[model samples]
Target: MRTLRRSRSRPWPLGEPTSPDGQISTVDLLLVRAALHAGATPGQAVTALHDRGGVLDTTARRIAAGEDLPALALDPACPGGPLVRALAVAEVAGAAAGPVLDGLVDGVVRAAELDRLVRTRSAQARLVARMLTTLPVVGAVGIAVFDTGARTFLTGPGGLVLVVVAGLLVVVASWWMRHLVASVGRAVRDVDPLVVAMRRIGRPAPGSVGVPPTPGEGLPTVEALELLAVSLAAGMPLVEAMGLVARLGPPAVRGQLRRAADGLRAGLPPFEAFPEGLAEAADVIDISRRWGAPAVASLRLLADDLGRRAAAASEAAAEQLSVRLVFPTTLLLVPAFGLLVVVPLVVSAFSGFRLGP
Candidate 1:
C-alpha cells in the first residue's frame, strides 16, 4: 500500500536518499531500504519517507529535487553526518549501493547500541554527582526552616566567615567532581587523551574520531579494518586501498598503512605485509577477498565488536569512578554540612540553656 512517485522523469538514485532539511537519521535509511524492497522507484521511496520534517528527510529531498549530493552531504548541517559522508564517498567512487548501504545500516545500528550503552552505564555516576551537589542547597533550606536562630548564627560574629568557607568548599568540590567525571567518562568512551590535551590547539575536523594507534589495543585495528572494507567494497585493490588509507587515516596509523602497502606491492601476503597490531585487519581483507566473501559485512561485525569493548571499558571505568568519588566528595560535604547546619544549631541550643537557667 506504499505510494510511489513514478511520474518524476529521473528515478530516485538507487540506495541514495532523496533530500530535506539537514536532519539525516538512520531511520531514514531504514525507510529507504524498505521502499526499495517494496519495488518503489527511488523517487517514490523519497516521497514515501515519513521523516519529511527531520534532518535526513530535508537533506534527502534536496538531493532528490536536484541539489548537489556531494556538496550537501559534506555540508556541516547534513543529518546523520557520518553516514552521509560514507554515502557521498560511495556515490563518488561508483561503489555498489547494496553492499555499501548494507554496511552503513549495520554501522548505524552498532553506533546506536553504543550510545545507549554509554548512557546506561554512566547513569549511576551522574546520579551520585547530582545528589552530592544538591546536599548543600537542601541543608541550607532545612536549617532555615527548623532552627529559628539560624538567621542569627549565619549573620553573627564568625557567621560571614563560616558562610564564605562553606560556600567555597561546596563550589570547589562540585566543580572538581564534575570535571573528573567528564574526563574519566571520555576516557571510557575511547576518546584520545592526546586529542583532549590538544583541545586548546583549535578544533579537530568533523567526524575525525579514528582511534589513536595505541599499541596492541583493538580500536585502531578495527578502524583500519573498516576502512579497508570500504575500499574493497569500492573495488579498489588491496595495495591501492592500503595506500589510500595511509594518506587519509589518522596521523598515528599512516606509517603503518604505508609500510603494509609497500609490502603488499612487493608481493608479500597480507599477513606478512602489515605491521604489528594491524596484521589481523590485513588478514581479514586477504581471506575475505580470496574466498570472495563480502568484506563489508565482516568489517561491520568488527566495528560492532569494538563498540562492545568500548562499552565494557566505560562500565568498568564508571565502577572505579564510584569508588574514587566516595572519600573526597564525602569528606568535603560532611565538614561543610557540620559547620553550616549542625554546629550552628548546637551553638544556639547551648545559648538557650544558659538563658533559661
Candidate 2:
C-alpha cells in the first residue's frame, strides 16, 4: 500500500493523482461539479478539488481512467450544494468565470456571516457599518488637503510657509473631523431605540417584509408602528395611521408602510394589508386578528423589543466612541493645537533673545 501510495504520489500523466482509499467525499464531487458548471477546465477543477482536501492522487487517476466513482458523490446534501447553486446561477447569468463566481460566492458567504454576527451583537455591527460608510469621505478629504499643500509648496518662499501652515491646519482639521465623524456615526448607528426595533423586526422569519435598516436610518418596525399606534389610539383611521407612520419612518420602511396603507385604503383588511415581505412576522398579524387586538399592538411589541436593543447598542457604541476619542484628542489634536498657538510665540522669544546676545 505504501509503495502504491508513493507511485501515486508521482505526478500523473494527465493531471494530479487522487488517493487510493476511495475516500472521495460527496462535497468534493459537488465542488468539482460546481467548478465545471462554472466553466473551469477539468484540470483546474481537479486542482481546486485537491486544494479543498476533497480527493487525492491515485483516486483522481482512477476517476480520470473512467473508473466508477461513487454515485453519492454529487448528492445535494453535500456541503458544496449551495456553491453549486451559485455556480449554476453564475453560468445562467453568463458570469461563470472563476473570479466572478468566486467573488459572488464569497460575498454571499460574507453576507450570511455578517447577518449572523449582526444579529448576535447588533450594536457592534451598526458601529462598524457606520465607520465603513464614512471612511471614503474621510480619505477623500485627506487626499485633497495633501494635494493642496503640495501645490502651495511648489509656488515660492511665502507660498512654502503658507503651505506648511495650511497643510498642518488641514491635517489637524482632518484628524478632528475623522474623530468627530467616527463618534457621531457610532452614536447614530448605535441608537438605542433603533437597534432594539431592528433586532425585533429584522429577525430571520418566513414572511418578514423588507430588508433590515441601514446604519443611519431610524429603527423601522418600532418607529413605524409606534407612530401608527399613537395615531390609531388618537382616533385616526387606519389609512391615516399608516400615512402618518410612512411620513415618520425611515425611507425604506416608509415606502413599505405607504404601500401597506394604500392597500388598506383600497379596502384590504388590517391583517391582509400587512406588507408582503413581512411574511415572517405573520404570527404577529395572526395574533392581532384572532385576539381582536389592535393591529398596531402586535407591531408595537416588536418595535419595543427593537427599541430596547437599539438602546443597548447605542450605549455600547457610545462607550466605545469615548474610548476611541481619547487617543486622537490627546495625542494628535492637543499637540497640533499647541503647535498652532505656541510655536510662533516661542519662535519670537528665541529671536528676541538672540538679538540681545
Candidate 3:
C-alpha cells in the first residue's frame, strides 16, 4: 500500500490578551484587523476578534483601522468593554454560521434601547406609587397628633366629645386617603389603551423590523402611502421616492419606508414589499399592483376604517363614563343631598309636635 501523504493545516493563535482591568489587549485588536483584512466589516471584525466579551462600536471601528485595541479600550468613553466583547463573540459565532452580522447588531441595539424604556417606565411608576402611599399616611398621623394636644386643653364632657369627633374624622380621612392611593396604584399597574394601540400598530411585518417613530416625528401610515403613491405616479423610481419620503417624513415612518425601499432595491417583487401589518388592507395592495395606479385610493379607504374605529372607541368610552357617573350621582349624591336638606326640616317639625305624657 502507498503511504498516505499527511495534510497540514495552519495553526490558530493561542488565547487573546486582556488588560490589567480585564479588557481587550493589543493582540486582540491585531486579530480584528486581520479579520477585516480578510473581508469582514468592522462589526464582523469585532465579533470575530473578541471571542468572549462585548465590543463597542467605536472600538470595533478602531480595530478595523488597525489601531491598538488595548489603548482604545482604556479610554473613559469606552466603558463596558468586557460586556461588549462577550456580545461580539456571540455575534461572531452567529456570523460564522452564515447569519448576517448587521441583523444581529440591529437586534441587540434595539432590544437594549427598549429594555431601557421599560426600566424607566417601571421606575417612574414605582416612585409615583411610593409617594401616593406615604404622603397621606404621614399627613394623617400629623393631624391626629395635633388633635390629641388640643384635647388636653379642654375639661368638660363637650370638649371630650369634640376630641372624639376629631379623632373619628382623622380615622375616616386616613381610610379615604388609603383607598385613593390603592386606586392610583391600580391605574399605574394597568396598561394604557394608547400604549396598547400603538404596540399593535407598530408590530413589525413578517421579515421586517419596525422602528419606533421619533418624538413628534414621522407621518401616519396613511400619509406615507399617499406620498408613495404620488411619487410613483410621477415617474420616480421606487427606491428614490422612498428615500425622499424618509427624508421629508417623520423619523418613525422614515425607518420603515427606508426598509421597504431597501427590499425593493434588493429586487424583492413589488407586491412582496407591502408591509405585513398592511395585510388587513390586502385588497388594496392587490388592486394597486394590478392597476398600477396610485396606492392613495387604498390607503384612503384604510384611513377611513381607522377613523371609524377610533370614533367608535371614543364613543364607547364616553358612554361608559356617563353611565358610571349617572349611578353615582343618582344613588349616592342625590340621597346625601336630600338627607342634608329635607331630613333636618322633618326632624325639627316632628320635635315641635310634642305629645303630652
Candidate 4:
C-alpha cells in the first residue's frame, strides 16, 4: 500500500500562492482536469494550469520539475487539497482516465458546494461573535464615560458594588460564549465534507441524519462503499475494486478495507465480506450480482439524496447559532446594561432632585 503523508501545520513549502488559510480553489481542480483530458502528464497538467492563475499556479513549476506529486497533494499546506488527493490517488493507481475524470468532476462539485456552506456558516459565526463582544462593551463605555450624572454615581459605594457584579457577569459571559462557539468550530473541523457525503450512502434511510460518527472509526466502511461503487461502474470486478479502494483511499482507512478485500478473495459472501456499517452497500452489491440491477446508479442517487440532507443539516446548524447567542446576551449583557447605564443614570437623577431641594 502507498503511504499517505501526515498533514502538517507548518508554513506551506514550495511557496504555494494559496490563501493563508490553506483552502484549495475549485477552479484550479477544473483546470487540472482539462489539462489531463487533453493528454498532458500530471506534472504537465499542473504546469499548464499556471496561466489560469490561483493558489495552485505557484506549485506548477515544482510539480513539472519532478517534485513528488502525491507528496505535494498530501501536504496539508498544499493548496491542491482533497481534490488533488483524489487525482494523485487516481494517477498513482494507474486507473483508467474516464473513471478518474468522473471522480474528479464529482469531487469538485461536492467540494465546491460544501465550501460554500462552510464559508456561509463561518461568516455568520464571525458576525455573531463581533456583536456579542462589541455591543455590551460599547454600551457600558458610553454610559460610564459620556454621561456626567452617571460618572458621578460611578465614584460612590453603590458604583463599587455594581462594578463587582458586572465584572463577574462579563467574565462568565465571555467564557461561556467562547465555549459554545469553539464547540461549533470543532464539530465542523472534525469531519471531512467528502466523508460526510460518502457516509450518507450507507445510512439505512434518507434524512436520518445523526451525530457524526467519530473520526477514523466509520471512515473505512463508507469510503470503501463510495470507491467500490465508482469502480464497479467502471467495470472493475468486485474483489479487484475492493483491493484498489484499500490501496487508494486515505491511509487511515486502508487497513480495515484491506482485510475486507482479503475476505472477498477468500470466498466470503458479499455481506460477510464488509463491515456492519456497510450492510446496505453489501445488500446493493448482492442485488447486482443476482439480478444485474445497476448498483452504481442506485448508489449514486442515494449519495446525492443524502448529500442534500447533509447540506440542509449544516444550514440548520448555522441558523441555530443566532438562537444560541441569546443565552449570553440575556444573562450577561442585559444585566451589564442595567448596572453600567440604567442604574447609574437613575441614581444620578435621584441625587439631583435632592440637591435641588
Candidate 3, superposed: residue stretches over 4 Å from native: 1-219, 237-239, 280-283, 318-357
lDDT of 2 by residue, 252-342 (tens): 3545666677777898765577665444344565676688776655655665555455545544544455355455445544454443333
Query: Candidate 4: misplaced stretches above 4 Å?
Result: 1-22, 50-62, 67-78, 102-129, 152-168, 171-225, 233-236, 251-277, 292-294, 350-357
Clashes of 1: 22
Better of 3 and 4 by TM-score: 4
lDDT tens per residue, model 4, 1-357: 001111112222211101133333455656766878888766667787765555566567667667866776544345544344455545555554445555545644664565466556656654766666566557767877888878777777888788788877777876666655544433432334334444555442222223333221212233445556666766777888777766555444454566668899999987898755456677878887799677876665554544455445545655566667689879787887778778888887787675433
- List model 1 lDDT by residue over 1-357, tens digit each: 000101111211211111121323466667766775676544344455534665456656676777654565435334444444444444554564445456556655554454455556656766777787668758877887788787678778786688788888888777666655654435532532223323433443233433332221224344456556677778887787777655444344455667778889999988898765564465666788799886667765765565565557656665566676676477787777777887778877776765433
Q: Write the per-residue lDDT of candidate 3 for residues 197-265, one digit (tens) a residue.
A: 345675743322254422111114533443444444455665666655444432233445566667778
Worst 10 residues of 2 by lDDT: 1-10
Worst 10 residues of 3 by lDDT: 1-10
lDDT of 1: 0.56
Arranged by lDDT, best first: 4, 1, 2, 3
List RMSD in Å for every model shown.
Answer: 10.0, 21.1, 19.8, 8.0
Per-candidate clash tally: 22, 29, 11, 0
Of 1 and 4, the candidate ahead on lDDT is 4
Cα TM-score per model? 0.65, 0.33, 0.33, 0.67
